[model samples]
Target: MLFSEAQEAFKKHLIYREMSGETVKGYMKDLRCFNRYMTDVYNGAIYVEDITTDDIEEYMHYLLDERELAPRSRNRYLFSLRSFLNYAVKKQWVEHNVASEVDPVKVMEEKKVALTEEEIDELLATIKHKIVKFSVAFLYYTGMRVNEAHNITFEDIDNERNRLLVNGKGKKQRYIPIAKSLKPHLENYLTNIRGPIDSPYLLATKKTGRLSAGYINYELHRATKELGWDKNVTCHALRRSFATNLLRKRVDVFKISKLLGHSSIKTTTVYLQLNENELQTDIDKL
Candidate 1:
């Protein structure tokens, strides 16, 4: 079958399985890039059967060498292609998934720098946009991903429960405790800045409805620069700060994993790096 033919079917499968809109868009974008590469490299026409393992390797090398994509980014492209090829194999369109045989790009592990509480306060106080200020603080306090926060509605928030029902990654729902510090911000945005909470989404833009992740990141980075913070402060950075601070405050790793909505505790372990004081305390305990 033609790659394009299989691509459409795979897209439908992804949508049917209820992948997030952003995820579906990313897959479509990667597949389109693959199709364009095949046309350029293979003289204009290619099929699923025409693709070989070597071709997959060459394309990865092109991304790493020519495009200078970071190891993680290159691995994501490989993953997208592998998923498509695997779908084709299940449908018997190809004898095997060549992309699957390829190894992922090796990424060196580096400890991510989580923002300090003082930095968080500085960033929030500097944000000129009232809606963005609340949106970012919401992420920092809740440790919710950008997409998960986008899915929140008024009904999802339980003021009495003092928690939020967030539709997290992998279609899982988790409740994050709302601090008393955050209550005023939430109350103000829902009752005033957004005006009537008519759209149901916790955060709304001037265009109406839930704010997009793109807008959140753009405004966050812009606001951080205005505060003279040269570091790349992003939505995820705020989420990381929440988790790291909790760990520093002696929160259980298991509880932190649950709060972060990680599919695995192993993912959460990456953020468990100890500072000098923390290590000294552990040493003293021993």
Candidate 2:
């Protein structure tokens, strides 16, 4: 079977499995270079089933050595190829998935940085725009992704439950309880900052449109420009601050994982990085 034929079948299967369109597109895009390599290096003569472990290793070497791609990026390519070939094996187009046996590039996790409570206050104080301030607050406090915060609607807020509906990655929806401290800020935005806007999005721009992720990121960096933070105050930094603070207060890691819309508790526990107060508290106890 041809690689192109297998590609379309794998894509259809992904769509059938309810994968997001963006995710499907990404998988297909990553495979394009591999397909090109097969055509160019082997003169388009290599059959999909006949492709061997040696062929895969050379491809991995080609990605890291010839292309000089980053490990994280190479891992993505490996993931795409592995998933595709696995699908082909199920269909009997390939006898075995050679790509599945290939190890992907290992991605090293960096030390997570979180904002100080004082630094958070300073950052929020610096944001003079009501909309930007409210947006940043929603991200920092609710532990929502920047896109989730940006695309939130008034209807998504549950006054009775005191939770906000978060549209998370891969089109999953979850509700996170709004903090008591954040409740007033949200109400303030609805009553005063929003100003009877017709736009359904909670964070509307000046023209009464949904705030784009880029615009929110731009405002965040702008606020942090003169603040001299040790780390750049990106959207993820606000999210990190939310998770770390909760962990610092002895909140259940599993609960925090759910609130953050993480599929794995491991992902949420990365924020358990020890702060000065935590280190000192443990040392004193010792």
Candidate 3:
């Protein structure tokens, strides 16, 4: 089948598997880029039968050399293409799963960047925009992922119980406790700043409905750049900083895991590694 034909089949498979819209879009974009590369660079049209392991290798190089994509991003594009090829193989559209035969790219282990307490304070203090400051503070205190923070609604806040109902990854529902220290700020952001009960979201654009994850990330990025921070700060970094700081404060790992709404304690174990130096110091004292 032609590249377009293969793409349509992949889209059908994604839809059948109930993949999210964003996921589907990413897969489609990656595959199309591959198709374009074949046509433009090699002057060769790609068919399901024409796809080879060599082509897959060349595509990886193209992503790095031509597209200048980061290792992590290149891996994600490779993953999307591999999934499509796997689907095509199962459907008998391709002779073999060329992606499986291709050697996988090695992803380097990068250290997690957690903000120090002083740095965190500086970042917070640097935020002159009240709304943005509170948003950052909420993430710092709640240890919520960017998407989770954006998912917050007025109704989600259980003031009496001091908890937040969050729809987390995989559409899983969990309750995250709000620190007593954050209650006043949360109330102020809601009543004074957020304004209007027409929308269910705690944070909404004046013209639109709920704030998107992209919007939150963009604001954080702009603020971080303006502050001249050496390290690239992201919205998710706030969540990581919260977890790392809590671990530094000697908070129970299990409790921290629950507050972060991590399905497994293993997911929260990265913070333990972050504290390895401190952990060794404590051990030496003992």
Candidate 4:
């Protein structure tokens, strides 16, 4: 089959499988780019069944060496190709999964970035806008993901219990204990700024609808840029900062994992990088 024909088939399969629109678009775009590269570089057509292990390796090299794509991006391309080839093999279009033979690009793990206490204070103080300021403070204190923070509602705020029920990843429900320190601020925001919204979503847009994650991110980026923070500060960074600070304060990792609604403690381990003393103590015990 022609490359375009194969592309349409893959797209249809993704749609049938109920993949997100963004995911479908990304896979199609990556595959199309690969097909174009094959035609331009090798002066040959690449049918779905005609893709080989060598072709995949060459494409990876082209992306890394020629295009200088980051390891994460290179891995994403590999993943897209791999999924396509697996589908083709299942349909008996290809004799084997060529992508399986091509090794995935290795991504080097970097230390998770967290804000120092001073930096967090600086960030909070720098936000001149009342709404933005409280939003940042809420993120820091609650350790909520940007999406979860945006979705919080007055109903979710159990003031009597001092805990908030959050709908998290995979639609899992978990209760996060709100710090008593933030109760006053939360009450103030609800009473003054977010008055009588029909929508249960706590953080509403200016017109009193649920806020989009993009808007929250844009505001955060604007604030961080204005403050000239040397480090990269994304909305998710607040979540990481919360986790790291808890670990630094000797908070139980298992408890942190549970609070974060992580299915495995292993996922939380990444955030708990040991200090030199901890590492040395472990080594000395051996």
Best by TM-score: 1
lDDT (0 to 1) per candidate: 0.85, 0.83, 0.80, 0.80
lDDT of 2: 0.83
Find the number of clashing residue pairs for candidate 3: 0
Candidate 1, superposed: residue stretches over 4 Å from native:
16-18, 64-68, 196-198, 227-230
Ranking by TM-score: 1, 3, 2, 4
> Over the stretch 152-215, how does candidate 3's per-residue lDDT look in tens digits?
8778988788789987765668988888767887878877887664777776767776666666
**Distance from true position, residue 85, model 1, in Å?**
1.8
**Global local distance difference test of model 3:** 0.80
TM-score per candidate, chains pooled: 0.88, 0.81, 0.84, 0.73
- Residue lDDT tens for model 1, 120-157: 88888888888889999899899898888888887998
Tell me how candidate 4 scores on lDDT.
0.80
Question: Which should have the higher lDDT, number 2 or number 4?
Answer: 2
Q: lDDT per residue, candidate 2, 14-43, as tens digits?
A: 999888666888998987788888888888
Candidate 1 has what TM-score?
A: 0.88
Worst 10 residues of 2 by lDDT: 224-233
lDDT tens digits by residue: candidate 4, 1-286: 7777878998999988876566788999999889999898768876777777888899999998999999989989999999998888888888888898888878897655678667788887777767766787788788887777887877888878889998876567899998876777787887787667677777775675777667666777777898887666767777788887788777999989988778899987765655577669768988
